[model samples]
Target chain A: MTKYQRIYQELLDKIKTKEYKTGDYLPSENELMKTYGSSRDTIRKALQLLLQNGYIQKVVGKGSVVLDSERIAFPVSGISSFKELKESMDGTIETIVEEFTVVPADDKLKDELHMDDGNVYIIERVRSINGEKIILDKDYLNGNIIQGLTKQHAQDSIYEYIENELNLNISFSRKEITVIPATKHDKEVLDMLDYDLLVCVKSYSYLEDATLFEYTISKHRPDKFRFVDFARRSQ
Target chain B: MTKYQRIYQELLDKIKTKEYKTGDYLPSENELMKTYGSSRDTIRKALQLLLQNGYIQKVVGKGSVVLDSERIAFPVSGISSFKELKESMDGTIETIVEEFTVVPADDKLKDELHMDDGNVYIIERVRSINGEKIILDKDYLNGNIIQGLTKQHAQDSIYEYIENELNLNISFSRKEITVIPATKHDKEVLDMLDYDLLVCVKSYSYLEDATLFEYTISKHRPDKFRFVDFARRSQ
Candidate 1:
């Protein structure tokens, strides 16, 4: 492998072994170059790859620091709803519910929510990190879950009230993410249309006994969304 | 809602309910115009929305046929890999394992695969449907599952060989899909460079005892890939 590649692999190995945890600082460019016996350009290239892959992030003066590893953790398994996950996260995160209503689920909605036998509660909202809108959440809830949900409740974390207040046991979730165009509604919900692309994450959540609890379709601004996975060799 | 939206929703409702199944034809423009009592331009607008969302596909001389719903029906309780799912779909598919090697499972990799100990086998591949490259797969397998795999054998379906030849029972998989730009290698593997967009899919498979057997990552040329999911609302 080339010198840069070698260094990249070594750094990856170190990160994997937990030599550096999320938010941990790494050596300066000069130090990394000195240790790896490489030039600044080569070292920068390696760092660029990690940044592009969402592994490490750089601050203006702080140099490079590990990101929150959980940000790109494995695709959720089993029953946790996006609503539930959002609720469970730190309270600093906020949501601006854009639309919520009782609409007959379309075939796409029916197929996604598995609502072949009934109506669906469609809720659309945007999630904010700090104060910036980063994710647009479009969810379909069984009318059975919340009989009379309104737009007022959607403005906050719905999952919080469902589990903490209503006392429902939220368990596992299956999710998928894809890219799509930014629709007019997306522009309105996010309050900005500077970007042209959106990353869509679709998820299905189930209860403790394996009963489906929530079906959510979310869209994130492409530049803001990152996904990560851990993999091993099969025998 | 606009008159056009009303027409669009009505048509969408029909397709969602399987009032039109795959390969089933819809009424012509003139027929729809009369039924919805709208002008030609208004009717066209409604039809355009359906086409944009992939609900119906229009043919040149034959008109429009209800497109197959792209939502996939995944057996949530079963322990099957994408390899097995394609195989059961029969010889209509082919796979080319591009690269395979034993790699150290890093913290991110360990976390994603839940591999707290030991090494992993990393496998990369492309899957084709009827000779068209549709999915690019990158996987990490548990070393204990397939200890002595050569790169040559990895070229074929590893899951099939594991179950039919090795006698290891492959059971359940948790998967996620997303969209990404084509990497330099993606161009070489998918054999395209002009289109920099790709759809990425990842799945984590488990053995009968819940041991993660494999972590598979796949990418596809977006225009050519359509995902199907059978979703259910949380109860």
Candidate 2:
């Protein structure tokens, strides 16, 4: 470990352990330099890593202010949905309900959902973060259980409606993630003309009673796709 | 849900419940068609999904053979290491130790590992699956703790050596996943001419005592990359 790295680890440990709580400004550069006996360059490098990792924000004149602990974390993701994660990010997020309709399950759609013959609700949404269109979400809901849905429901949180209003438990999900080329639809909608890759996370969600209820494919511009995980060794 | 999807779900449920055990051949297409009153195409479609999803494999002389339950699963990955997952996959996997040397920790290397000044072991390896070079794994070990590591250890499994030989309790890791354009090294080493995208999983691993000892960057060709996750709702 070099001087900057040692300082980074120590400061990060302090931040995570709440020795430096959220909203508290970190010590000035001079203070950190004096404490570590590291040069100004070394201190700045440590602070830069913290900023890049979203641990702290360098205010123009107020030094580095610790961000919300829950809003940011050691890893950006655990088990949160796009809406949930975006809410924590506190960015200017907007969900555009591009298309919301009910259709008799086609063979392909039925196959994807593992269904026989029933109506399904389709929701096509584009997610813009910080004024940039980065994610396109396509969802298929079992219309039998989800008897009613509207654009308003699509714009807001559909999961919230399913769990709260419909009183269903969102138990678990199986997600298959892959990176693939951008499709025509993605090219047209996503603001990633220069970048050619997209990270697709296709999920099959189940209810508490073991009912497979939803299938969603979320396509994100590669640069905007950030997946972080914390894995505890399984016994 | 259509009739075929319902059948798919039922058969999948049976396979998962072990009603259709590993090595137990599934009911014939004729039998399934008769039982479900579905057409041959529909039954074939359902079986195709089963095959695609790795539930069963078709044999020319024999019917679809039930696959190894653990070798194949509902989702491919959980908390397993690359070797662990590959072994379960039953693939002919080869790990070539390209470079294994001890380097004085440079500032960048030290910064990545959060260290001040110590010797660090660099291990560069290429992973081939079924004869195709699909992954490149670069590992950095904290030489201060590892003391010594040989190329033979890299050829086998570093984690295994750490646990069985060194008696280190492997704890947890923080992983960051992203998709990016292939680098020059990636293009030169990986046998992925047609594929231009790469999925990168960079990890920082710590010991049971919270000693950060390992840093790894695993680069994979996009088509060969499959990240499956199972998320249980947290309270």
Candidate 3:
């Protein structure tokens, strides 16, 4: 690892261990430089990384202060799998596969998935947390790339299968969040009643090589949907 | 600027200028290396920065594909000011100040803002783009740090005043997005009659000194609210 990366990781570990609690100020630049035996620039670079990662916030007069880590709820800021998201949260989550089929890409699918002409696998699932249905996920994956998707894989974690079984590198994603009126499909699948609004998340998942492999529309019940993000000022 | 930053900026300029139009593949690493007289690793670093900033998506077999930049509408992924947001969009925008007052922090406000016994300046405004009322901004700024708030500042841009006049470095923010049933305040102030749902964005903005300086609740008409984010996998 790079020097700055090592420093950043060490500081992050300190924050995670509660050695540097929330509202506590970190060591000053001079102190960190002395302890790490590094230059001010190097120390600042490490601090910048920590700031970007939402571990600490730099104060003008004071030093970097540890932010309340508990405040980050349902981190939708980064490209993460459902399994990873479940691991981060506290609850027994279950995925129920509603439908799994391979179909030719229609005009709407072509426009939405940005694919010219191909067959795509459509997987419908309802995710529940502690027996409460919250999300209805409809995924359209490129059949050419993601082959042999079965109902068993859908019931489990498709992302895990894609990564472990297929050995495909899930690289990045472009996500758009909006609120829309709940449709009949959403109401039926999510078991949502009297919830007029659904938080819709449309995502385009890309492979490591930058191929857009999957398009998903996740409809979430309004009360159950909350997206949290940590953002820095773009300089 | 560093070599990688310079290269990233140059490539971004090319994309913006349509020298590398949308759907066009960027030059290969070898070609970029030859042109820039840089190492392969250095070129890759430049390309990685471009990918992070959403200028280009690297396709495995197809090199880097220029994504349609116009598809990103009103980016809520980052912590940006209203003035900055307006500058990025087209059409005339106006802000109507509804209320401006200085009030002592209540129990809820104190806890939410992370402030002790202190006063706060509450400002409410309605934002219109292309003569369409879309956003309702309710900002509660710490009176100690952010002082001298007036109706003019609310009508203009309070963020601009905070940065320019107050000379405070706005650092970061934690944002939470959810859909809620429109309240009476939202209906009356935002001139909403038929709209049932509102996209609610609650944000806590901190200064460079790691002090929570402001708390804002931005409510938007469901149809008009959209958030776009470009995210990479955490390896």
Candidate 4:
């Protein structure tokens, strides 16, 4: 499964079956190296893994264009997981786990979980989908490196028991985002009406040995948030 | 300026003079290879240019940490320019230019500017900082690859006249972000009475030959937005 991951899974199944739609273009690294007999550095490594997974956008003399695959609606530009953003959306998600404790680290949670003194855990949650709500999260962790968390690991999936039962490794994050104004605990947990904004986000995470260990926030519901991203310009 | 850009400008001036504050750490790479007699791959290429400029966050066995130098508020996570984000804040920044023109492309501006049916330009503007009106923008471009745009290049700096008088090379973007509710041309241009959210963004850009040319949107005013970012975990 590697001739540039089989031409990046046959151009991501012909761009999810729209048969290469959104502004078309693709097909010319010498016509995808003579239709996949390959090599123009394996069709530019399958168009640089479809331009790093946002599914195509190269464009210069115009080659790999096709973007707008619903521009990944609520993707929050990487470091995913909430069961991989609820299996990339369709509905019926849920979640709930309202609060799980441990506490102790104040001083703004020890400078927002850079952690130095002690005790941590916290949690919260809410989420939901085809039945409204729309995110809330909260988290915190780093109680001496995430120990014994339960409440069925925050009703299943505390990043899948912190990477499959504490093997750890999670890696990076740093987010931020903003918007604010709806608290009263987001007007009592979620389905906000007359929505006076909320978005928020925050984040921090880490740990592929560079441990900073979680620190979330989440929030959303400002018309059910969205993010996407991609960037590059830094020559 | 080399020797890892003079140790990344003396650790970005000791993290903007908090004398290495926010979550501290730094120092070791054999103590900056014995205080700069250098090597340890030039202090890990000056801490990978302070973790690619968000200033610092390494942390594995815990080394380069010091982040939160006001984690770049309203930075809109890169692909900058509104005069490089009003020369990174502390502000007077204005702009105005309400609407420029050119037109034609319709059909949702030729699939949101992937363009194939000529004529484009557009523009619009607003911005501001010390004098209030948070932001608005609009843009579009690609009139056969951005030609003679004026209104004094939309009140000075249409990406510095597309990279110094149309030499053109801009490069990357994709963005998205969201929020909405506030248009009446954002409550008649900007300070939305006690804000009913706005944020927006959208984007597209491209160019160092991979041309898409442009497409924008912008918006803001959700408490003058903020974005940040920095991700990584794709393993």
Sort by TM-score, best first. 3, 2, 1, 4
Q: What does candidate 3's lDDT look like per residue over A170-216, in tens digits?
A: 98788999888888778777867677778889998988766779999
State the lDDT of candidate 1 residue by residue for B1-235, as single tens digits: 8899888898888888888886688898888889988787788778766754445656656666665554434322234556657754645777787777787788987887776777788888777777777678887887766677677667666777777787876643444555677788788777553567676666666554445677777777755554433222222
Question: Which candidate achieves the best TM-score against the true structure?
Answer: 3
Ranked by lDDT from best down, the candidates are: 3, 4, 2, 1
Each model's TM-score? 0.50, 0.69, 0.86, 0.33
lDDT for model 1 comes to 0.66
Local accuracy by lDDT, each model: 0.66, 0.78, 0.84, 0.79
> What docking grade applies to model 1?
incorrect
At residue B113, give the lDDT of candidate 4: 75
How close to the true structure is residue A135 of candidate 3, measured as C-alpha lDDT? 93
Give one digit per residue, the lDDT tens place, for model 3 in B1-235: 8897788889989988899998899999999999999999789879877776677888766698887776655377788888888887889898988889999999998988878888999988899888888899999999888888788988878889989999988888989998778888788777565787788899999888778899999999988888998777763
Clashes of each: 41, 12, 4, 8
**Per-residue lDDT of model 2, residues B1-235, tens digit only:** 7777788888888998899987788888888999999898789778866754546655545576665445325333534566677765766989888889999999998887768989999998999998999999999999987875898989888888888899987865667788777888888888986877788998877666556799999899887887876555643
**Which is better, 1 or 2, measured by TM-score?**
2
> TM-score of chain B, per candidate?
0.58, 0.68, 0.81, 0.33
